[model samples]
Target: MQEATETTHSTAPQLAAPAAESSVRRTVLLAFVIILVALLGVFASRFSVSPRGAASPALLVATQPALAITAALAAMIVSLLIALTLAKPINAVVSLFALGCAFAAYAMQTGTISDFVFLGANFKLAALETIAWSVFIALAAIITFRVGGPLVDVPAHNRDGTFTGEIIHKRALMSLLAAVLAIPVLIFTMIGASKGQAIGACAIAGVLTSVIGRMIAPRAQPILLFAMPALVIGLAQLALAFATTISPDIAFVNATLSPIRVPMPMDIATGSLIGVAIGLGWSKGLVKHEPPSMHDE
Candidate 1:
């Protein structure tokens, strides 16, 4: 009987794997379908875009589709890294915001911005942004079981149905809002079919990042959550600034980011400011978790 029970326990989990896989497969396929519908709209753009839209159209045209696609893939990896460092609500929101900004920037630069319409993912770089932005968002939503620091609190009802727990994050619905806002980015990620695979990879990576971040970040919250990530980002920005100053890449430089330029000192200051902001924000919502009196789960 003991041997039979052990074999049954092992088989039950294995049996469930295929069903879970199927569900995931279906979800990804649905996402692709949504992407395809948005791509079809790109063909409907009213603009009669000329072959030489700019003075040096040839030079602009010289860059390969491959390079653009590669940058996008790299951007996905960066997005994942950024997502990994983010707090649940903040992380997802930041990714969606970043991708949306990146998409808008790309559209404006390419002169493909349509003022009259809000057609989704009609411009270049939109699909990749969409996929990556949504990935982390989805993952954040899935892990509803949050395990944050002693700082954050989850809402719960008492045995007598009284509101017993402090819920600071209820108003901060990061995952849901992030996913909704990421729709356009998702469309852009697949606008170019060649990059479909990388975009998917980004989404998968983002989701994985969210899962890992959710588990790890909260545990490291009291110490490294704010400090470590901010420090690292500051260091990276400094490096990027130094590299660009020494040898600027016209394609790589962020036009809007120039205002807050870079360097170790500036980067460190910016990082310190960000850390301070996080510290202050979390502190304002600080709540203590007492031992549960009763559980119905």
Candidate 2:
């Protein structure tokens, strides 16, 4: 019995090591991915805004991009820490907030998908931007999968051939809420696009979304892993624009429009109320669905 027990113990680690290795690889890959997303934000800001460190007229893109990237990176890190650690309940609250901010930013900056309310975008991607988003989505899948941990669904042969409902895992849901902590980063994008104190407000919106989703169904984890860099750089750049009064005076026909706005931070009372709701009201909220397979979109 002693010898048999020893053999089983030895084999157990061997079984576990592969998953551990995969986890390490995922972490490294995600770190690199974080850097890449930040760089993209930097690049995006170079074209639209006249940043402080903007070098000579010709090579200005390189200098201006870094600050925007840095702010995004900061938001990404903090939000993740909050979600993965003590404040997991805030996920759902932030998710809705982020979802709203994303569409709002898109609306404020690029113009609506259509003049008519519910249709496709009037302005599609600039080819390169579309490609960049595609790459981001792929990276997001890797991040989401890593956070969710190992999956061991029933085998196809043992399972019915016909489709059945998803097999939900509690650990997966917890991991997802942890991951969705990166909420503030996306709100920055809304701030970047807005015309008033929308940046801080949008940043606050991010916090609110996490708070709300924490109340509702729990914002999906994938929302945090990718959306962070997307919004933060925009937020940073917008804040900078708002600070120095450097934004373009976009004209509608003749008169110039008002300058861009940063979002406001939520009041302490509101933040507390939302946080309490997220903490108490929807403790049982679950991530909506399992992420798509790694094979493709």
Candidate 3:
């Protein structure tokens, strides 16, 4: 019996090593696929935008809305194909968000949002364009999830432990906490006044939020966790914008509040989607495990 036990123990590491290596490889490949799709989407979307000129905000003024919309559609189609081929439908949805992020980051770098607000440009039209992008991307995500196979249920023990009776409320609270925790990180990273900062900030915020969020709410859906932060940030920005309309003094205060810099909606969405995927991949096996199931089938 002693020898039999020793033999089993000796083989266990050998079996586990290959599985661990395989998991790492899969994660790296997934990250690469997402990054590649995002780059492709950015390239496709930018092809339609006219080159920047000596005039300030010329890029925004020169861009034709119809052409830009067409570019966004083309980018989405390309990203969807690549994501479906390389990953799953859920990943395809993430890729679409990443594409939007890429576009928004570019816009931010070129001072599009600030120009819209301060330059007497048609801010409403710009806002409408953003809304259109969000609606279409969200619809795509919903459709993909619906068409994809149903999500596998986590074992009940893994989902809810000693506090089974209050698990619903606990999950909701933890999810909210996770979103709140992520807000500062997003704001800090995005407050920088440098070009191309939004993309990096979003990526950082997303990964950090997911890692911390998973620890607090292991049973929460990753997508839900990701979305909560973006939703919170987006709503906060909208509220601030509305406040600016109530009084010019409020607008001045908003402009001076460096810490409360407004990021494009797509920036938040992109960060949450891609960051969560990366975080979940990198933090696999690091989270605390629930007790082994007592009711074995």
Candidate 4:
């Protein structure tokens, strides 16, 4: 009976792996469905004025009742899914969402005497702006989980005297890490897609950089940790641009490199901000584990 009990205890984790995978799979599926519905709803809304009968195209394009509403709802939904996965509350996610939106609005806001408000002239673009701006904020929140720190279930020295951070199987650790990383990307991708943007690649790259950086140099300085990936990306873009100038590959450049727009300050800023956030979050996590951190099951 003692032998049987010992065997069961050893095999418990192996059995739990399948259950955890199933839960993750379900969460991903649910998030996907929500995103699809959100996109369909946005397009279905009749916020854009019909171009055929409009007296002024600009005025027509500027008026957007549906888009604003859709964006708010989408933001909330996206934020909630992310929050749930990260083991954070709705309030935290909401704060991040608001910050992102504010940043976008500030960047887009004009200093013109007539139009001092951000995106004031083109309110119709609010949704796209929110989605784009929030990409970094969302990515930062996700990074806080992967290499950020451990979310311990109990104190280091429990009554039983078992340390929570005891070494586990390599496969189990990898699986946990993968699930923790994937959840944010999944939600971020869905949000980006809903807004007709491609910020998914940026998030993926940012997370990977954070993970690899931690493994290679766990004690690296926060600033360097954050800035290195962005620098590498910038250099890569520079190389690509040089290559394009020497080769007659306009088609390839336009198709693949156009969207990345490495020459643009905005793109560089976005990437760098994401990296900094990731590094900062990782450093914080390394310092200590606390409540509200993304729970990696």
Candidate 5:
């Protein structure tokens, strides 16, 4: 018995070594995936907006709307594939945010919002393009959740595929409130002249938005609420930009049309993803309840 116990103790460290090594490898792989996804997203965004080597945002959007839509769709498909086959939902979401971060970084380096600026009829086209991309990406994500539910270990709330009237109403109300509150908070936090400041602002906005969301709807999924601040800020910026075209003479309109301060998709993506994971109490808030698998049953 003593010899058996000694043998078991001696093998424990050997067994643990492989587990630790596997963990490190996973961490490394996740990091690589984040970087790769971010780069790909940036590449896709650049390709979409500047298909013909156009320098002007208005010209690019005006001429290449189809290409823009296609590029955005492709990027989202790639993201969905990654999520379904390689990464957890959380990791996949973080990768999406990394893509947003890449956008923010590029914008910062450019030192101007001119790349994103659109005017007249092109403004409408640009808006349509944005909406198309958003809708496509959202649908892709939904499909991933639905199809890969069991494989990805989707939360019970998401996998259930049923929402009562009361739940819908409550979620909608909370979402509206979060969007309204997020605007000012995002604007204020995003007020800075440097890239680090801009990134920091996004982080702050994400954390605050997550906190606010949790306060208002404690039972709601954190992932659902994470993008609220970014969406609100993006819409506000779009509105302000459109208003500038309507009233080009208005100093306030022109002054307020700073896309540099507006959180890029990735910025909000990264910030909100992390904020939700960390701020909402990861074990409880992120996972909630998982339904049993067929094997378990």
Candidate 6:
């Protein structure tokens, strides 16, 4: 009887190990689902403005291409900032906030699609695009964080500090060159009508991302920076394609009047490149550093 009890007790932890792991996985999945639901809620809220409502010419003109583009860009930038900030610890509350911000960003970008009452089309492509973009960006950012390892927050320093200006200059210069070089590669890739622009863009983006990540968090690991960009740009292309096929009038609004829209290959290339630029640009900052080693004689 004692032997049997000992055996059961000894095996309990072994059995619990798998259960623990499964529980962790379940928790993570639940968190992700909650985040998705929050983002969906944000997208659905666009209807509060009554996308199906009619508007006067003045009202329509008031929300022109320029203002719309600016608003959309602002929303995306804000959401990205929030996401990067919240990504470090992966706390539930912060993650949910980041998810909301991300959805808001996509919602802003797709506002024109949703608010195109003039089109007279009942298609809910706008909401769908918003949802798709939000989910894509959120997942991409999370994956990037996971792959990149924990983000190290380094302190900022001016010239003559332990982190010399030279080092900063070097990293900055390298990242800038990478970004600059990416432009021509992107342009040529687009002009040649090559499908490899995505690859080229991703490569450049990765290099720049690493540089920026290290700068932001001195010990930050290398992550897939291009994923988010690729997803965003790819989805945009798909949305445009859908719009074009569904209704020429809708396509015209999106293609011609929408400042955010670009031509097929160029649009994809540009959107992705911009995403990379934003990632790199914002990442350029401070990071925590290890204390200097001591040398005792």
* Candidate 5 residue runs with Cα over 4 Å from true position: 1-8, 46-63, 88-111, 115-137, 144-179, 192-200, 215-219, 238-297
RMSD of 6: 12.2
Greater lDDT among 4 and 5 belongs to: 5
Colliding pairs, model 3: none
Off by over 4 Å in 6: 1-86, 90-173, 191-297
Error of 2 at 255 (Å): 25
Clash counts per candidate, in order, are 11, 28, 0, 1, 2, 4
The alpha-carbon deviation from the true structure for residue 85 of candidate 3, after best TM-score superposition, in angstroms, is 2.7
TM-score of each: 0.25, 0.32, 0.60, 0.32, 0.63, 0.34
Q: What does the lDDT come to for candidate 5?
A: 0.47
* Residue 56 lDDT (model 6): 11
Residue 267, model 1: Cα distance from true site in angstroms: 25
In candidate 2, how many Å is residue 229 off?
Answer: 15
Deviating ranges (above 4 Å) for candidate 4? 1-78, 81-204, 212-259, 262-297
Give each model's whole-structure lDDT. Answer: 0.30, 0.31, 0.51, 0.35, 0.47, 0.39
lDDT of 3 by residue, 20-44 (tens): 9977875775576657765765565
- lDDT of predicted model 2: 0.31
Candidate with best lDDT: 3
lDDT of prediction 4: 0.35
Best by TM-score: 5
Query: lDDT by residue for model 5 over 71-121, one digit each (tens)?
Result: 645765665455444335334444434444443433333221233432323
Better of 2 and 4 by TM-score: 2
Give the lDDT ranking, best first.
Answer: 3, 5, 6, 4, 2, 1
Give the runs in model 3 whose Cα sits over 4 Å from its true position: 1-36, 47-62, 88-177, 245-261, 282-286, 291-297
Mind giving the per-residue lDDT tens digits that candidate 1 earns over 38-65?
A: 2322222112232344211111121343
lDDT of 6: 0.39
Candidate 2: 10-residue stretch with minimal lDDT: 113-122
Candidate 6's residue-wise lDDT over 130-194, tens digit each? 33443454454444455333334433323234322423343333333333333343344432212
